[model samples]
Each structure stands twice: as C-alpha cells, then as structure tokens.
Target chain A: MNDDDILEQAARWRSEGKGVALATVVSTWGSSPRPAGSHLAVDQDGAMIGSVSGGCIEGAVVLEAQEAIKSGNPRLLEFGVSDEDAWAVGLACGGRVQVYVEPIE
Target chain B: MKGALLDRLLAERAAKRPAALVTSLNGGGQSLVTAEETHGDLALPLNVVAAARTALRSDRSGIVEADHSRFFIRVYNPPLRIAVVGAVHIAQALAPMAALAGYEVTVIDPRQAFATESRFPGVRLVTEWPDEALGALRPDRRTAVVTLTHDPKLDDPALEVALRSDAFYIGALGSTRTQAKRLHRLQELGFNQEQLGRIHGPIGLKLGGRAPAEIAIAILAEATQVLHQGEAAEAEAAGAL
Candidate 1:
C-alpha cells in the first residue's frame, strides 16, 4: 500500500487497541530503495504494513519500532551499506537512509 | 504523535489541504504546519516553519536543519489530478494511463454515449457540461486540465475556467491555426496575454505521434514536464518574493 493508505491502516490498528509504531524514511541518499516520507507501520504483535525500504532492512526496523511502542520513546535510525551491520540489515543497495520511528499514541 | 494530532493530520489531508509534519530528531518533538496554523508538542522557529512551507509548495519531503537541531519535514500535498474535458478516443487512452502514473483522472463529457461506464472502466466519469464540471472540480496547483473536445461550446467554457484558475498545466488539443483562433476568442473574453499563454494549445509534446495512444503519451509527457518545471518556477518565484 502507499504510505497514505498505510497511515489509514495504522489509524485502524490504533483504534483497535493494538499498540502501533510508525517508521518513516525521513531522508535518503544515493540509490535508496524508497524516497523520504515512505512509511512502515508496525503493531505490538510485530505485524507490519508499508515499507521504509526494500525488504532488506524491514526486520531491523520492526525491532526498533516495537521497542518504540513499548518504551513510548522514538528512535532515529540510520543505515548505510558502509555500516558494520551492512551485511545483516543495511540496505543492500549502495545507499543511505534515516528512519524515524515513533509510537502512534 | 498524539492520536488527536494524527486524526487532524488525516482530516487535513482528506480535505486536500496542504500541510506538513515536522519532527525534531533530537527530542522527537513534533508539530503540524498548515497554511494558517501550527500545532503540536513543539513550537518550531519561524525558519523551520518557513522550510516546511517550502517543502509543501515543492511537494518534497526532506531533512531541514535549523538552530542546532535536525528536523524532518514531511509534506502532505493533494494527489496530482488530471481533468480531461472530453471522453474522446484519446481520453479513452489517457485516463487509465494517467491513473497508472498516480494521477486522479477525471473524464468530463456531457455526452452520455461518449462517457459511458464501459468506455471508462475504473476511471471517474463526469457527464456534465464542461464548464460546470470544471467549476465543481476546482482545479488547483496540482491539477492539469486538458480540453480535448475541440468544440468551441465545450472547450471554450472549460478553457475560461482553467485559465482563470491556478491549474499547473492547461492544454487544449488543436493545430497551430486552431490554437491561434482559440486564443483570439479567449482574449476577446478578457483574458490577458499571459493568462492566455498558459494554455498549451496544439496540446502535448511534439512527439510526432498520430495514434490515439501515442498522442496520449505525448500529452502526458508535456503535462508531467509542466508539473515539475512549474513547481521549480513557483519555488523560484517564492524565493524572489
């Protein structure tokens, strides 16, 4: 779904009493998979919708989003191909992106 | 992101009102900026709010750094819209193609036979007179209005409304001679030269294509060009001001 539809879905999940977090690609550089403003919605059960990147970094983002939901604290996550975690969760493409994850309180 | 703020943002978007969500990375403090107001946990500085307005105008989302903090401004502008004022064969090709390109396509034609559901499956069909239809549609900066009817009664009224509005792109299908004649008529109707110039007559990029679908592609290409270039021009104008 597009980010707007995902936002609507996030609202639905929020109304349903599912603790939800919103992760948005706030900025990108080089061959980033998605543009800034791309969104990924994560719920308490780890269910997710939309995407902040290609399938590569979603698992890591979901973990952070779940943490934000639990702690009621937001996180600014930066990932790039040059990072030590590149092999595990960084974008496979040679690009960098900053994601902001916050609970949908 | 309070639930009430989220709802207000959604409501503003639903109403096609331009807005932005600004968040400071350091504190996670956020604010919503609209044309008239700003509200949220943070009271952003004037420069940051100005940056958000610029982002809204250009329809770009990005990072804005000010006052030793990093802020992300996520702009929420209305979806690009195309109001094709004729359900002719070209529009039969243009409507779905524009939709695929992420435009909200509306085919306006009063002729029921030409504007039937079968002709425009999965596209919005407005079987009202061109002028009335466009009047209600209220074309905005993100809207592109194209008159393909090639009839003065229909195209003229639509052109009048379009030329009076801030529609980013206004195209009318015709040859050079026809365009000249159309311009004369609009000029007689009180539109100044600059306003008349906004109409991209002989519509579409001169791709030298003749088929309906090929012509549609040319029109879409020209419209897309105007959409982006117009945004740049507007930004330059705002900067000048």
Candidate 2:
C-alpha cells in the first residue's frame, strides 16, 4: 500500500476507537530495501498496512508500534545488519535503518 | 494526522494535487504543504520548509535537517499524464505502452471514427477538438503533450496549448519540411524562439524503424529521457542552491 492508504487506514482505525501507531523509516545507512519516508501503520491488534524495511525488521517494528499505541509514547527503533542476530531478524542485506514509531494521539 | 487535517490531505491526494506531508521526527508534529498553502500545526523551521518545498517540486520523498531537528517530507504527486493529440495508428500502439510505463494516457481526436473505444481499449479517449481537449486537460509539469496528427489544423491548436502550459515535454511527429512550416506558423503566432525551442519537432529519436509500433517506441524513449533528465536537472539546481 502507498503512504496515503496506510494513513487512511490509521485514520479509520482511530475513528473506530481502536488504538493506532505509525512507523516510518526516517534514515538508512546502507543498502536498505525501502527508502526514507516509507511508512507502516499498525493497530492495537498488531494489524499492519504498509512496510518500513520490506520483510526485514517489519515484525519487530510492528511489535514496537503496538507497544507505542498502548503506552501513548513514541519510540525510535534502529536495526543494523552488523547485529549478531541480524539475519534472524531479516536484515541480511547489510543495511541499517532507523524507524520512528508514534501513537496516533 | 487525524480528523480534519488527515481528511484534507486525503482529499488533496484524491484531487491529484501535488503536496508534501511534513512530519517532525523529534516533535511528532505533522503538516501538509501544497503549492498554495500549508495546513496543520507543523511548526517546522524555515530551512525544513524550504527543503520540503524542494522535495515536493521534484516529486521525491526524503528526510532533511533544520534548526537541530529532523523532518521527513513525504511527497504526493499525481501520476504522469501523456496527451497524444492524434488517434492515428501510432496512438493505438503508444497508449498501451505508455500506460504500461505508468503514465495516464489520453488520446485526443475530433475524428470520432478513429477515436473509438474499439480502436483504443482501456485508454482515455477525448473526441473534442485538439485545442478544447488540451485546454481542459490543463497539462502541467508532469504532463507530456505529443501531436501525432500531421494535419496542421489539428496539430497547431494542440501545439499552442502545450507551448503555453507547463508541460514538461512537447513533441510533434512530422518530417523536416513539415516541422519547418509548423515552426514558421508558430513564430508568426508570436511564440518566441525560446518558447518554440521547447518543441521536439520531427519528434522521437531516430530508431531506424518504419512501423507504427517502432515509432511509438521511439517517442516513448525520447519522452522518458526528457522526463528523467528534467528531474536530474532540478536536483542539480537544488544541490547548487
């Protein structure tokens, strides 16, 4: 989905009284799969609408987003390929990404 | 973004208006910026606004820094539109190819027989006069206007509209002598040399192909070159600034 679609979904979720959070790729250091400004919208139930790091790190980001929605606080999450378990988390492309997750409030 | 601001942004996107969504990564503020105005309480620094405007103009989304803060500018631009001012055989071939390349193609011709849905399936067909059709289309910076009609009556009016608008690429399919005559006519109509220079007369790169499909391919290739190079030129200008 495009950014507009994800944002629209977030708006719908908010209007429906469900908690929502948005995760956006703010920066990339190496061969990141997606570019900056890529977005992923998550509801309280962990349903997502878009992607931040393609398949890599989305699961982690979604988990963080759900937590942010519950806590009403934003979090900045970073994932780098140099991490010991990078491949296990799907960052095998040798890139680093910074994602900012914030609640819809 | 929520409520009215998000609704307004979605409406802008639906209207095909070029805009930018500026998000403050540190402060968690968001705003929508268009050519006309900025909406929402996105108290961005001046430098960040400048950078966001640049990104919006180039139809690119990225991050920028200003006043010790980082902001992401997400650009929203309408799809590239191509107005081919002839429903000739070449239009039949070009429309689908251009659509495959992600351009919204419109084939215009006053001749209803040639501009039928049977001839060009899944392409926007405008059967009005060239001038009227082009005027209503309002070709902008992301639009490419190509005149495939050899008839001076049909082609000239379309050329006039394309020349006056912000269309990025203006091409006319014709031979050398035909192009010369067209140029002379346009000059007589008060178009300056620089304005007339925008026309890629005898349009399309010479690909040594005589078939209609080959000609369509050549036009698409030339149009793509102009479109991408125009973006590069804008990027260079922004970097220099």
Candidate 3:
C-alpha cells in the first residue's frame, strides 16, 4: 500500500477505537531497501500493513510500534549493518535506517 | 494528522490536485500544502512551505531541514498519463507497455471499429475526435501525448493541442519527409519554430525495427527518456536561476 493508504487505515483504526501506530523511515544512511518516506501502520492487535526497511527490521519495528501504541509516546529506532544481529535478519547490506514510530491520536 | 487535515489531504488526492504533506519529526506536527492554499495547523514556517512546494514540483518525497526542524515532505501528484491518439496496431502495443510502466494509458480514436475494447483490454478508450479528446484530457506536465495515425486530419489536430498544452513529451510517428510537410503546415498555422521543435517527429529512438511491437518499444523508451531527462534539464535550469 502507498503512504496514503497506510495513513487512511490508521485513521480508520483510530475511529474504530483500535490503537494504531505509524512507523516511517525518517532517514537512511546507505543501501536502504525503501526510501525515506516509506511507512508501516500497525494496529493494537498486531495487524500491520506497508513496509519500512523491506524485510530486515519489520518485526523489530512492529514490536516497537505496539509498545508505542500502548505508551502513547513516539519512539525513534535505528538499525544498521554493524549491529550484532544484522546478519541474522539479512540487513548486512552495509546500510543504516532510522525509523520513527508514533501513535495516531 | 487525524482530523480536518487528513480529510483535506484525501480530498485533494481524490480530486487529482498536486499536494504535499509536510510532517515535522521533532514536534510531530503535520501540514498539507497545495498550489492554491495551505491546510491544517502545523504552524510550519514560510521557508518550509516553500521547500514543500518545490518538492511537490519535483514529484519526490524526502526530508528537508528548516530552522533546526527536520520535516518530511511527501509529494502527492496525479499518476503519469500517456495518451496515444490512434487505436492502431502500434497503439495496441504501446498502450499495454505504458500501463505496465505505471502510466495511465488512454487510446483515442474516433473510428469505432479500431477503438474496440478487445484490442486494448483494461485501457481507457476514447472514440471522440483527437482534438476533442485531447482538449478534454488537458495533458499537463505529467502527461505524454503521442500521435500514431499518419492521417493529417487526425494527427495534425492532436499535435496542435498537445503543443499548446504543458505535456512533457509530444511525439508524432512519421518519416523525415512527412515531418517536414507537417512542420510546414503547422508553421503556416502560425506555430513558431521553437514551438514546433517540441514535437519529436520521426518519433521514438531509432532502433531500426519495422515490426509494430518493436516500434512500440522504441517509442516508449524514447518517451521515458524525454520525460526523465526533461525534468533533469528543468531542474538544472531552476538551479541556475
């Protein structure tokens, strides 16, 4: 889905009384899978749509997004190839990506 | 991001208006900036709004720093459109290719027999006269208009409308001699040399292919080249300015 579709889904989730968090790739250092404005929308029930770092960090980001939805606070998470577990999840492309996760209010 | 602002953003997109959504990372504020007006209460600075408009024109989304605040400007332009003004064999090949390349393809031909749905599946077909269809479509900078019909009554009228519009690429399929004759006729109609120069007569990259599909490939390739390189040239011009 495009950014608009993700945002629209977030709006729908909010109206439906379900907690929602929007994760956006705010910046990338190198060889990022998606561009800076890519988004991922996660609901309170773990239902998710869209993508941020292709498949490398989506699970981690989704977990963090659920936490943000609960705490009602935004979180900025960063992932890079130099991380210890980078190779385990296939992010060893010598790149770093910063994602911002914020709850929809 | 969940009230009037989101509503307006969706409305603008639905109406096919060019817009940008600016989100401030530090403050978590959002603003919708359109060519006609700015919506929402993000309290964005003038410089940020200016930068957002520039991003809209470039049809790209990225982060911009203004006054120590980093804002993501998400551009929302209408989909790229390509109107092929002849539902011939070439149009049959080009329409599907253009659609596959993520362009909204429209095949226009007044002849009902040629503009059938079976020939061009899942493509918008217009059976009106070329000029009438083009006028209604109003090809803009995001549009590329190509005239494939060799008939003067059909191709010339469409070319006239395309030249006057802001379409990024205007191409006509013809030989050198045919193009010269067409240019002479257009010149007599009072089009300046520079204006006529916008038409890529003998259209498409010279791939030396005679098959209809091969010709279509060349045309689409040339159109893509012009669309991207033309934007680069305009960006250079703007930077120089």
Candidate 4:
C-alpha cells in the first residue's frame, strides 16, 4: 500500500485506544516476490496495513505483530523456504525475509 | 498531537517526496508524552477523523504514548532521483519505468530530437551535452544513473562523475565486448580496477531479452537489488562488526 494509506491506518488505530504494531520487510534474499522496504501495519484486532508478501507471509507476520502489540514487546520474524523445518511456509522462489516488528500503542 | 505527525507524513508522501512511515511492530516505540495536548484529554477522545481535521494545522510530532509502552510513527523524507544519460530506445523504455518506480527522472542527451517531451513523457528531459548535464545532476545515496548511449564520448565523462558520487547504482548498457572497451577507456582516465568494478557494465541482469521493455525491467530489478543489498562491502563490514 502507499505510505499515506499506511499512515492513515496507523493514525486510526492509535486514536481508537487500540494497540498498533509496524512490520517492515527490512531485507529479502533470493527470488523474493515482494520488494524490500515493503511495509505492513498490524493492529491488536488482526487488521493490517500495506503488504509484505503477496499472501504467503502476511498472515504469519500479522500474527507476530499482534503478539508484540499486545505484549508491548518487539521481535524479528523470519519466513523462508529453507529445508528441514521449512514444511510450514515454503516460498516457490526460495525467498527469505527478515521482518522488523515494533509495537505501537 | 499523534494525528498531526501522521498527517505530515501523508502530505510529504503525496507531494512525491520519498517519505518513510516507520511503524513500531516489536521494537520499543518512542513515546512523545509531551506530544499530548497540554489542555487536557477529550471527554470523548478525538478519533482519527477528528484528529485529521487540524492534523496539518499543528506542528505536533506523530507519536502516542501511555507510558514506556508507546508507539512511534516517524516520517523519514528521502528524495527520489534518477539521471539517465541517453536518448536511445532503451532510454525511452527506462525513463517511464523510473517514474513508475517513484524516481524523479532526468534525461540528459546531446540530441534535442531524441530527447523531447513527446519522446519521453513525464521525464525531465535536458537536451544538453553529457559531461555538462551530469554536472547538474546530484548523485546522492538514493539517486541512480544509467548510461544507455553506448557512446564512449558521451558516456565516459558522465560515468566518471557518477563513479565519484554516492549514487546507489551506476549501470551502463551494451554487450560484454562494448562494455570492455568502455571500461578500458575509464581505466585510461585513471579509475582503478576496484572503482571500475562498481559499474554494472553490460547493464541489467541477464534477462536474455532483446526487447527494450524487457531490458528496462532487468535494469529496474538490478537497481532494486542494489538499493536493498546496502553494498556487499558494507554488508561484510557489518558482519565483521
């Protein structure tokens, strides 16, 4: 989504007394679908802003952000197509991303 | 107060400035306790719709805080610039792509016929000689330059100027042989092997397509890669740290 859209959503969340969190696609490796710097904002209610991956990783990232927003903690989440423990989330292009999450309430 | 900060960010972005909207996901969100209204809280708290009413009216920074637990919404302004030194077919394709990719594109060419408004729609076309044109273009960290002229006389001086700057990517289009000759000349001009290595010679990734549009896509992709990778040497330095 555009920066304005994201900012608008963020403002809306903060005003409503709801917890908010921002997730950024800080870095991506090999054959990634989404560009780095793509952003998504998540509220305590599972609402989202922007998009990181097409649809593959948003749910996972939203879940991560929700926890942070609720707990007022931060985290770095990773999703990739690595083998062994990669059965849950497997990207077709073997893309991996480092997500920086910050809680905002 | 939080609303005012958010509105500034939106305005900057709408104005086509490279503004970054930083949200707090899992990091400690910066608290702007002083950002609160000194008057008092609303009996019915001002919703965002209400907040946006005078969002741009105030100079309040955009951060909301209850305590140490707070969220930051910072807008970072980064300029978007692209200097394209050519009026060739590839440049025609590349110019709009730069615009679509959010760059303030400047097309510098010695040929007025080749570099015109009709030819490059929405591009800032400067029909001037290369060396002089390159001098006008600012090469910042966010800027990128592409030399599609494939002419040593036009490309060399501009490329030299670009090489000395902090532009994220410097690409020159042509086959490997032509690229080799161009680099040889750059070397004669006193650029070392390491500096010469910085150029994305034979520009664009090996998309193996002859179409100008396809070549443009490869160049965009390569540019995006360079922008995010943060430089291999810098990455290595970070690793060492």
| The best candidate in terms of lDDT | 1
- Tell me, by DockQ, which candidate is best: 1
lDDT of 3 at B195: 99
Better candidate number, 3 or 4, judged by TM-score: 3
Q: Candidate 1: deviation at residue B221, Å?
A: 3.0
Residue B37, candidate 1: C-alpha displacement in angstroms:
1.9
Cα error, residue B163 of model 4, in Å, equals 1.1
Clashes of 4: 13
Give the candidates in order of DockQ, highest first: 1, 3, 2, 4
Residue-level lDDT tens digits of model 3 in A1-105: 455677688778878999888888878888988877788999998899989976888888888999998898887778887877666666766799888888876
Per-model TM against the reference? 0.88, 0.78, 0.83, 0.60
> What is the per-residue lDDT of model 1 for residues B1-241, given as tens digits with 9 covering 90 to 100?
7888889888997897899999998888899999999989988999999989988988878887899999989988877899999899999999988987778899999999899999888889998899999999999988999999989999999999998898999999999999999999999999999899899989999999999999999999999999888777866776621
What is the per-residue lDDT of model 3 for residues B114-201, given as tens digits with 9 covering 90 to 100? Answer: 9999998888999999999999999999999999999999999999999999999999999999999999999999999999999998
Writing each residue's lDDT as its tens digit, candidate 2 over B60-107 gives: 677887888878787877778999999999999999899877688999
lDDT of 3 at A19: 89
What class would a CAPRI assessor give candidate 3's docking?
acceptable
Off by over 4 Å in 4: A1-105, B10-80, B231-241
Please tell me what DockQ candidate 3 reaches.
0.43
lDDT, residue B174, candidate 1: 94
Candidate 3 off by > 4 Å: A1-20, A40-60, A83-88, B175-181, B205-217, B234-241
Q: What's model 1's TM-score?
A: 0.88
Q: In model 3, what lDDT does residue A60 have?
A: 85
1 or 3, which is superior by DockQ?
1
Per-prediction TM-score, chain B alone: 0.91, 0.87, 0.90, 0.72
- Which sequence of candidate numbers ranks them by TM-score, best first? 1, 3, 2, 4
Better of 1 and 2 by DockQ: 1
What TM-score does model 3 achieve against the real structure?
Answer: 0.83
